[model samples]
Target: MYKLLVIEDDVMMSDMLSMYMSGEGYEIKQAENGEQGLKLLEQFVPDVVLLDLMLPDWDGTELCIRMRQHSTVPIMIVSMKSEVSERVQALRAGADDYLCKPFSMHELSARVEALIRRARLMQPNAAGGQQEEAGQASEKEIKLDSERRLLLVRGTFVETTFSEFEIMKLFLTHPGKVFSREDLINAIRGFDSFVTDRAIDVHIVNLRRKVEKNPKEPHYIRTVWGVGYKYVTEVEATR
Candidate 1:
C-alpha cells in the first residue's frame, strides 16, 4: 500500500481525505499543522504529501520548500486559495501539484496513484538498473542540477522551488517546444488539477524574474503569442 501524509488544518477535510484515501488502500497519516507534519516525516517517510496552504503555525509553501530540501516525495497542494497568484506562489514554493478546494475525492485518489507510479518508475532498481537522464541541448551558461534541484545562472546558483525546478527541467530539456498553459499545468500537476491558465502566466513571470536578464523581454522563456510558451536555447538568444 502507498503511504500518504496529509497536512491539513481543517478537521473535517482532513478526516474526509484520510477516510477516503484509506478506503482506496493507502496508509493514511494526518497532521493538523506544518510542525506536526515535519515531525511525522521523521517518523515515517511518505510516498506522497497532501499539504494545505493555510496552517495555524506555518506557511504551506515554506513547508514544501523545506520538505523538498531532503526528500523528492511527491507533494500535492490541496488548498482553498484558487487565485492565479496563489497557485503560482505555491508552485514556486516547491509543490509538485495543486488541487483547489472542493475537488473530487476520486480525482485526488487518481493523482496520488499517478505520483506513486511515477516515483516507482524513476527509482533505481535493486538489480542495478538505472533510469536514463535527460541531457541539455544547449551550451548556455545556465544550468539546472536535477539532483540538487538548483538553477545556476552564469555560475551563480539560484534557488528554486520543486515546481519551478520541474517547469524549468521540462523547458530546458526540450528547448524550442511550445508548452501550452494546459500542457504545463498537466505536466507539473495532473490533468485533473484545477489551476487556472493565468497561473501558468504567473509562474512564467516569476521564473523570468529569477533567470532572465530582462523580465520585460524574456530570452530563456518566451511567449509564443496566442499559443503558449517556449524555451529559447540559442547562444545569442539573450539580450
Candidate 2:
C-alpha cells in the first residue's frame, strides 16, 4: 500500500483527511505541527506528503525546502492560501503539486494518486525489466533517458524536478512546437491541479537556469513573445 504523511494543524481537517485517505487504501500518518511533520517524514518515509502551509512551528515553504534536501518524495501542498504568489512560493520551494483548501476529497485523492504514479514512473527500476537506451536524435548536446528519468546536458547529468524533466521531455521530443503555459500545466500536473501561468513561468525560469548556457539569452528553449515557449530544433540549436 502507498504511504501518506499529512501535516496539518487543524485537528478536524487532519482527522477527516486521514479517515478518507485511509479508506482509499493509503497508510496514513498525521502530524499536528511542522516539527512533528519533519520527524514523521524521516520515520514514515511516505510515498506522498500532504502538507499544510500554516504549521505552528515552521512556514510550509521552508519545510518544503528542508524536506526536498533530504528526499525527492512528492509533496502536495494542501492549504487555505489560494494566492498565486503563495502557490508559486511553494512550487519554487520544491513542492510537486498544490491543492488549495476547502477541496473535494475526490479531487484530492486523484491528485495524490497522480503524484504517486509520476513518482513511480521516475524510478529507474519501476518498469521491472531491462532498461531501454536513452532517447535522443542527432542533437548531441542534450540527451533524455526516459527509462531512468534522467537528463544529461553536454554529457553531464543535471538535476531536475519532476515537472522540469517532463517539460524537457515534451520539448525535446517535439522540437519547435510551441506549448502554451496552459498546455505545460496540464502536461505536468494534469487537469485537476490548481496551476497558474506564473507557476509555469517559474518552472521555465528554473529550467533555463539549469540547462541553458545563458539563461538571460536562452538558446535551447526560446520564448515566443506573447504565445508561449518552444524548444529549438537541431538546426536552430546549432546556429
Candidate 3:
C-alpha cells in the first residue's frame, strides 16, 4: 500500500481526497499546515507528498525546499496557480510535479503512479550508482558538477538553474540521442506535468545563452527541426 501525505488546508478537498485515496488502497495522512506536515513526516514517511502552495504557516516553496533537505520523496504540488513561472518556481524548489486547480482526479492518480515509478527507477541515480565520475569530462568533453549544481563548458563555469541543469545533464548524458519535448518534460519534471512549451523553450534558451559561445549559432544543442533537440557530439575522422 502506497502511503500518501497530503499537506493541504482545504478541508473539503482533503476530506474528499482522503475518502477517494483510501478507497484506492493508499494510506492517507493529512496536515493542515506546513508545520504539522513537517511534524507528521517524522512519524509517517510517505511514498509521495501532495503539497499545497497556500499553507497558513509556511510558504509552499520554502516547505518544498525544506523537505528536499532531508528527503527525496516525490512531491506533487496541487495549487490553484497555473502560471508557467509559478510552476517553474515550484519545480526548481524541488517539487517533482505540479497540478493546477480544478484538475481531474483520474489525471492526479495517473501522475501519482508515474511519479512513484519514476522515483523507483531513479533510486540508482540517487544512490550514486548511475552518476558519471564527478569533475571528469565525458567523451563529448563537457563536465557537469551536479554536487555543486554547476555546468562547465570547455572547463569554464556557467550559470544554470535546476531546470536548465537537469535538461543539460540529460542531453549531455545521451550525447546524440534526440529528446522530444514530452520526453524531456517526463525526465526532468514528472509525466504529464503542468509545464508549458514556453517553459521548456525558456530553459533551452537560457542554457544556450550560458553554454554556447553564441546562442544564435549553437554547436552543442541542436534542434531537430520539427522533432526535438539533441546534443551534438564531435566525430573524429579515422585516418
Best by TM-score: 3
Worst 10 residues of 1 by lDDT: 125-134
lDDT tens per residue, model 1, 1-239:
88899999999999999999999998989999999999887787999999998999989888988887878788899988888787777766666678988999998988888788766754532112111112334444676765467888877899876556667877766668899888787766652255578877878888898888889988789899888999887453843
The candidate that wins on lDDT is 2
Candidate 3 lDDT, tens digit per residue, 124-216? 554452344442234335557654557877778876776787788777666677888887776766523556777887888888888777899
Q: After superposing candidate 1, which stretches have Cα over 4 Å from the reference?
A: 125-143, 146-148, 152-164, 167-186, 189-239
- Reference-based TM-score, model 1: 0.63
| Candidate 2 Cα outliers beyond 4 Å, as residue runs | 125-152, 155-165, 169-185, 190-239
Report the Cα lDDT for residue 152, model 1: 81
Clashing pairs in 3: none
Q: How many clashes in each candidate?
A: 1, 0, 0
TM-score of each: 0.63, 0.66, 0.69
Q: Assess candidate 2 and give its lDDT.
A: 0.83
